[model samples]
Target: MKIDTQGDTIRIYDFNAEECFRIARRLENQSLKLYQGIKAAIKDADIAAALDILIAEELCHLAYCEKALIDMGVDDINAEHLVEVVDTGVVTPLAQADIERVLCNRQEALKLGIALEKRAIAFYESILAETGNEQGRIALGNIIEQERGHRERLQALIS
Candidate 1:
């Protein structure tokens, strides 16, 4: 799949819950892959637990998006949500080393993840500004925060 879907990255400016759901679904898939890769690379129990938490957070975010779509009545409308996937090269298995030492491939993925989160946060922040209803604005604000949280977590992973 095309990872960095080009064209207005600011689509959330006019987005409803369905849009969020679509994007969240993509993020959920990407996060699953990321966590699985990290799990394979690390042997430590605590790091694995942290990765598990990250995966669950992504799932929860996806659920929130889906619920919003359902509530907005756009879940049935079927449109491409433009969720970008991570680069496939990052998934390659290696002999592996210190998780604290940094894996180059995972680092690349982390960089991309940060950029994606920035875009998502910007999108929702703009939407929150434009949203006519309180619920929509609140949802956008919350989603923006979630994306920001992910960005911070991913930043920590690479650093």
Candidate 2:
């Protein structure tokens, strides 16, 4: 999306709505898989419950993205984008044991999540730069904030 910046407020528009939506879908899918892995890996009841909650949250995220696409008049939300795939990395399946082992060795998963979020933030920021409009900038900034939230949430889990 394109964005115009004025102080802390930004106005944004002119975004590749389809591309963003596609990215969102892929990211949500990745999150769901990660949580599934964590759920399988963690033997602790509390941790397993927490991972399940995160999985549910990602489901909501996917639904929210779908809704956003519909609201923006972007049809066919499943279309894949090379940028989303390449930039976000391959959607690998994490075994429950592999993810469960992470509770004691959490750095691996935490760092991966952080990297994914960073890439997502950069992608949206780049899109905003392309648009170079007020509304687009605003929208991209909001996305950046959202990515930060993801980072924060993941950090809580890891650290």
Candidate 3:
């Protein structure tokens, strides 16, 4: 699951529903890979166990993104008729190199987790702000809260 930071980080200020969900799914996949890689690198069982929970959460989120696309009948992203416009960029999770540089210990891993969750929350919030449909706004709100919970859990582990 190698992601090119430059290509994947292209900001799409105006995107339709299909594009939104596809980008979300892509971010979730990146997140899952990051957590899995970190879990593989860490020796401590306790930290690995925590990463397992985060990985599971990311999986659920990814599934939700897929289901959303299905429910919307979005067979393809045409990049036409956007829901709203805003200053939005691709939500980039920590790259492989960033993860490796930061994963010195359990504490550092937890810190990275916090940062990852923060990015997720920010991405959803930005989308939420620009979302015109009530359903989309509600869904984005729920996702933002879930990401916040992930951040709080990592913070508790660090404390």
Which has the greatest lDDT?
A: 3
lDDT by candidate, in order shown: 0.57, 0.63, 0.67
Residue-by-residue lDDT tens digits, candidate 2, 53-140:
5666577667867887787776665666553554444345445555445575446555556655667677666667676556445545
Task: Give the winner by lDDT: 2 or 3.
Answer: 3
Clashing pairs in 3: none
Global lDDT for candidate 2? 0.63
Where model 1 places Cα greater than 4 Å from the true spot, the runs are 1-13, 75-123, 126-138, 148-159
- Candidate 3, residue 103: lDDT: 57
Clashes of each: 0, 18, 0
Tens-place lDDT digits, model 1, residues 40-94: 7776665566566566767777777767777777746346544333222222332
lDDT of 3 by residue, 1-159 (tens): 111246558434333456566656677777788788778887877677777777887888788877887888776533433332322343353467767755555677677767878877787777666666665566666567767876887798789
| TM-score for each predicted model, relative to the true structure | 0.51, 0.60, 0.65
In angstroms, how far off is 21's CA in candidate 3?
2.9
Q: For residue 51, give model 1's deviation from the true position in Å.
A: 0.6
- Number of the predicted model whose TM-score against the real structure is largest: 3
Which wins on lDDT, candidate 1 or candidate 2? 2
